[model samples]
Target chain A: MLDSALSVFRMGRNMARLMEGLGVTLEISVVAVGLSLIFGVPLGLMMAGSNRPLKWLLRGYLEFVRVMPILALLFIFYYSLSKFWNINLSALTVSIFVFTLWGAAEMGDLVRGAVTSLPRHQWDSARALGLSEGQVSFRVIIPQAIRRLLPGVINLTTRMIKTTPFVFFINLPDLLKVGQQIVEVSGLRYPLASVWVYGFIFIIYFVICYPISLFSRYLERRWAS
Target chain B: MRRARFLIVALALALAMIVSVKAQAGDLDDIKAAGKIRIAVFGDKPPFGFIDENGANQGYDVYLAKRLVTDLFGSPDKVEWVLVEAASRIEVLQANKADLVLANFTVTAERATQVDFAKPYMKVALGVASPKSALISKVEDLKGKTLIVTKGTTSDTYFSKNHPEIKLLKFDQNTEAFNALRDGRAAGLAHDNTFLFAWTKDNVNFVTGIDFLGDEDTIAPAVKKGQTQLLAWVSERIEKLIAEGFFEKAYAATLAPAFGPAVDPKSVLIEKLN
Candidate 1:
């Protein structure tokens, strides 16, 4: 127990190097998820309310984003943009761009689900009150659907945070990448170095993600009850 | 529901069998009889093995695998190329996912205990590169600066063991490390000298400093441990191929496009071992 405790302290000193990486991870996750909500909500509303042709085109796009692997899409964007146009953007930009694409599709689907699940009477009642079609969606439907959208959005935020590790493939020095580098550097010092480093990473992930997940659950329970 | 469940289970079993069959390692005669050899080559590293812009697999290691397979099976098409990364090339060979790995694989004593290496086919050493504007040239210049290295590479191990003061960023792929250097996120990118030579040649903005780090090492193909028959056959075939100028032809065809005119096969090739 004493030996293990000493190792943890040693590893803690090393792991302090990863704070900047954690900051990077949180920064990108917030930007990607925020962008997803900003754009995805409107796209979702369009899919829900638009004409058949527009809806079909939007649906096709959503499906494409949903089905395509994020990692593969990241490579396509990273390599193709750099090779063809000489636009060698930073890894953080590429990551935020790809995650926005993925998160938006997911958020759009959530919006569609939440909006569609509302009874037809809700739409009719809003229109019955002198509200125009746009006003009905904006003032009546979306306001009520906000409760339902909250839990799903929070869930996606957690997932986006989890998936930030893929940015390492493009050379973004995010949390997981830093952890890997730490392990590579210090793993040989003691057999427990990897365990300490990886365990600390796991705990850090838990601390960040657990609270968000709990908040999501609390929101779900609050709304449901 | 019961019948559907049965069908699903049967299908899963069949799929499992097929996957297991695909991963089986063949002995020397079984491989020849099967009329195909599965070789793992790095899909990221250039000049040795990599996927071309056209999406076709092409490079020195790839050319050698094709020639070796054709010489054995009488057809170039009788070879399967499995794309492997630096860290898992030997694991792929050990797992029977590949019969041989020709992925610019340097023979290390630690790796030799896990996989059997054929005779040396090329000589290589660690090379460090930095941006031209940085004026960062050698190992000493890397003090208090971040250097990028691919994970599980000799450079990563070397720096971790020797120069612990130099902060290192480890990327899983070579392209990522190069990108780090390109983006100015890292002061230097260190890896095999041959690869650095090719990289600096292609991207002139970066200059190679510290042309060689540590002692020189030899690159060779690796097979699964205890596969003595396969090992002997591969070693003998490489020696014969070297004597018959097969490597020279391969070098001219694949690497000469990137490595330029002065590279002679004999300087890199090792042959005629028991």
Candidate 2:
């Protein structure tokens, strides 16, 4: 146990190398998730309202995004686009594109659920106050819905961070891919290299996601009060 | 309830049979009886083993494998090509999923313990290539730059041991390493000299430095350990092929197209086993 711990510590010294990879992962995830919410919120608000054809169109998109695995989508946009057509895209661009689509669908669905689940009387009372439909939604209903949306959005952001490893398929030097590279090379000298490298990756992921979970809890409590 | 129990028992027995069948390993006799040989080869790497536009597996390694199957089973049709990347080649052999691995598989003392290697059919050395726009002209240029290499390859092991100061980015596939170089993610890409040469020839934008690192690695067919009969069979077959100038013929067929007309097949071919 002590020997393994020492190896893990030794590996940690090279955390700077892994940090470069983490930078890429964080940048991609933040942009993808941020853009997803920007576009998704409006689409969700539209879906929540009774726009018959729009709802049906959004339902199909949401179902397709939900059912399709992120890896498959990444490949379609990365390999097939470049191979069949002459359209070559950078790995980072393809990853952000796929994740944005994924995040939009997921975020849109969460917003729809939060918006539609409120008691029907909340809308009637907002309109009863002589507020415009747009003003009622923007000021009253959306504010209440946001509190409910916060936890889901934070959870999705964590998911986005975790899924960033799939960028390796398209040759992006993301965190998990870097760890895999280190493990591959170092396995020659240290028999326990995988244990060390993968253990550190696990810890790094926990360090990232655990805080989000705590923040979500804090948000839930603050919003509840 | 009784009928359902009977059905469950039948399903359990069927599952047991399938698992046991898969667990059964093949020897030379079993391979002969089955009339088919499963060989693992690289699917993306050109001049070695790659799938062409017609979806046909064509390359030097593929040709050698076809020749081996022809000599063994009296026809080249009795072969199954399992496409493997650099990292998965050894795993496929160790798992007993492949009867032979004819990928541009390098022979090393460390790898010998995991699998038995036959007499080498070809020889190659590690070489480096960088984009034309990049200032990396020699080995010293790579001092602070990131070097790209395929994971589980000899290049990966070579750089990791020799150059600790240089940042290394390893990819699971050769195409990924090549892509990394083109994308400017890494300053240079390192691999076998023949592969680097071929790649640089096709991609005029990149140039290979004159410096070659590491020892000349002999490319040989690898078989699962403890398969003495199979190993001896492959070794003898390689010796026969070498005597017949089979490697030269394969080079003419696959590598000659990528490499210029002046490229000699004899330069890479090994006539005798060490």
Candidate 3:
């Protein structure tokens, strides 16, 4: 049983291919998450502020994203966008674009929740000190919001990482794709190949996501104290 | 209000940029000017197009794709291999993501309307591979029985249209269909006879009892619809390859090894196109 389990890795560059796939997964997750933080924080601040039409527009966008499935979004951007709009983005580019759009929306909502949940006096006090609105936002409100939002951000990062496997549908060779490829080829030789390959992939995902999850918990505890 | 206006302007500009970039179908000149041909091939289906253990593409379709690239550019390295799933083969062409699709793409009237196919290099027909214990040898035997087929494949279309009584379980990937068959979730798995023959050889427990079904179909490379120049070039290249016995050589190297000596090469190979 053990021999059969180890046989998948004995195949040519299977481990290396898995590593390459992991790299792709991380690449998409990191870029999407980074871009989400960059764009989403400001978008969230706007949503929290007194901007009526802007809030309505942002809410519409967020609700649309929430209602639409990620898989459908991927298919739209990867296939339909090019066909209808005549703009051909590569599969990798499309995956990143879709993920960033999704991540940004989720992050924006989380940030809005974090900022809005804070005590109202913190904002009033900052404004009472003769600080401008921008100063009150950047100096007083944001710092406190970060403490509340970091754990959620890390959770989003993990969610984005996990969702990267959906790129396989669009033909991006992410981690699960590489695993499927390995299982397909190796199944010819070893009947137990899928068990080993999928089990390994499951472990790889856990190893990557667990630490980030741990760090989130650690921050929650640290900030609670 | 100012920020909202700015945001609206930014989105409008982005939309304008996207609209302004016209999608151009890659013709012979475009491919030559680009100095590379993007060819789509399957990453999972074996004996036709599959990635080897070395993480490099190895299969009959991949071999043909490489040769086509070499002949066009005088070097094999000028080809960008776009791995595709069965369902996305036509989508890739329509989207201009791939210049040609040589991914065991069986020719059909419905598909021809979407993408122009060159002369065929191989011929195929649907076949059913079932467990030896309860072998399915004929269409009548499959009545009321569940059959596994890959979505967007000829088998799926055939079973759905003609054999509606035979319940079908469809999967997006070839590997998943085979897995369903192995796990005894279905009575039989139907795919191209050429593929089933090769597959049954590796899998001793299964046998391709029904070796041929439906009308005989030709498998050929396809370019985006209206890409007349590329389509002409591909047709000419296929004739040249046939005259030189390139497919026979490819068969000997790739398919023969997978099929073993019992299977005749001429049965599946299309040496001359009418």
Best DockQ goes to which candidate?
Answer: 3
Candidate 3 deviant stretches above 4 angstroms: A126-135, B1-24, B128-191, B271-274
lDDT of 1: 0.77
Which residue pairs in candidate 2 have backbone atoms (N, alpha carbon, C) closer than 3 angstroms, thus clashing? none
Interface RMSD in angstroms for candidate 1: 18.3
Model 3 lDDT tens row, A1-225: 899877689778988999999999989988988999998998898888789999999999899888999999999998898888776788889899999999899889999999999999998898889999889988998889999898789888988899999998888999899888888777878889999999999999999999988988898898889
What does the lDDT come to for candidate 2? 0.80
Q: Which number leads on lDDT?
A: 3
Identify the superior model by lDDT, candidate 1 or candidate 2: 2
Reference-based lDDT, each prediction: 0.77, 0.80, 0.89
Top of the candidates by TM-score: 3
Per-candidate TM equals 0.48, 0.49, 0.86
Error of 3 at A137 (Å): 3.3
Q: Tens digits of per-residue lDDT for model 2 on A1-225? A: 568546544654346657777888888988998999998999898889788999999999999999999989987786566433435566689899999999999999999999998889998998998999899888989999988888889989998989898886665668786666555444534668778878888888898888989988897898889
What TM-score would chain B of candidate 3 score versus the native chain B?
0.75
Each prediction's DockQ? 0.02, 0.02, 0.58
Question: Which residue segments of model 1 deviate by more than 4 Å?
Answer: A1-13, B1-274
- Per-residue lDDT of model 3, residues B61-120, tens digit only: 999999999989999999888989988999998888899999988888999989999999
Cα lDDT, model 1, residue B147: 91
